[model samples]
Target: MKATEMRSDCPISSSLDIFGDKWSLLIVRDLMLHKSRTYGDFTKSAEKIATNILANRLQLLEDNGIIIKLPYPGNKVKGLYRLSPKGVDLIPALIEIALWGGRNISNTYDGSPFLKEVKKSKTKFLKKVMDDLLEEETNIG
Candidate 1:
């Protein structure tokens, strides 16, 4: 299903419809942090996502314009997935969620380098993330 065809009654629901699943957001997190681009990269994550589920989530992300698949420069048969502008815009939301979890939830994912960077300089970190994402998008295009 396409994002355009999703319900519009509640904005939150609309977003949830597209990215409600645990694995999908995790995939986005991996892209945002680890710069994981290939299917193998995602499948080999610590969460150990199943192969079929990973494939489905990747397709969903691509269909929703959250990511774009580009041919690996050296290998036409293999492609790398990178965040689209729409996906990059999600960084602030992800950061906020991570901050909330760190504050309120015990035993949260503890080793996030990005979260540490945000803790040091939130404004600068966010700006840098946007700049980097924009640069990547420009290069890809």
Candidate 2:
């Protein structure tokens, strides 16, 4: 939304104001898994987010400086989306959420491998993931 529209000065609330939607974090998750993704790629996600909602989330994320939209190579009608550094910073939080879900949710999808990596050494896992993302952004630039 906007700075003036935030529900409170609470950090959590403020952050949510920017990305408190069902699909925004999913979009962020996809970018975490790849250097860049196209609109078409997002549409193909298992979540099957609607085109209108996807379009809106993309715009909202870009507006909030959480993602960067770039011209897709040799494509006039598509754009590549990747997380901005701010978005990358959310990885730790996402990991925590994943950990919680894995432990508390019933019938959660198999994510043992990743969870094991984090449980084995959260520091190392975060460092590698964040470093990889930083490298990807640098290379893109």
Candidate 3:
């Protein structure tokens, strides 16, 4: 569904309106897991997202309050992106998706020992990721 069109009032539909595209969640994943900040960092993802699509997804995410664009003191030309609390809250979901893929999908990651802990305790992992995201936000903001 298009961003402007509300398919339904369902929470899932609402979320999909903003991030159901191929690239948005990957952008989030990068920020949440890899500490990506600059446009250059996103463009460098292994999936090789197109510059135009990456730009579109970044704007959409920022508009939806899933992420915030921060000023980069080191580089005036490039913007820095960080997860808001709402975005940070998606960590558990990401962990679930990763665990599902790792279990059902072929050749997926075994993840790290930390990830094993995440699988056992999603709440704990969520808190950890949230804490880290907020700390990054504090340092940057």
Query: Where does candidate 2 stray beyond 4 Å?
Result: 1-4
How are the candidates ranked when ordered by lDDT, highest leading? 2, 1, 3
Candidate 2 lDDT tens digits, 25-135: 999988877668999999999999999999989988998888999887788998889888888888898889878888899987755667788778878888988888789
- Superposition TM-score, candidate 1 onto the true structure: 0.88
Tens digit per residue, CA lDDT, model 1, 1-141: 545456777988888888988888888888887543788888778999999899999999999999888887788778888888888888888888888998889888667787788888878888887777777767765
Tens-place lDDT digits, model 3, residues 1-141:
145576999988977877887788889888887554799899888899999898888888887788889888787887888888788877777777778877898876577665687777878777777778778877877
TM-score of 2: 0.89
- lDDT on C-alpha atoms for all candidate structures: 0.82, 0.85, 0.80
Model 3 deviation from native, Cα RMSD in Å: 2.4
Tell me the deviation in Å of residue 61 in model 1: 0.9
Which has the greatest TM-score?
2
Better of 2 and 3 by TM-score: 2
lDDT of candidate 3? 0.80
Clashing pairs in 2: none
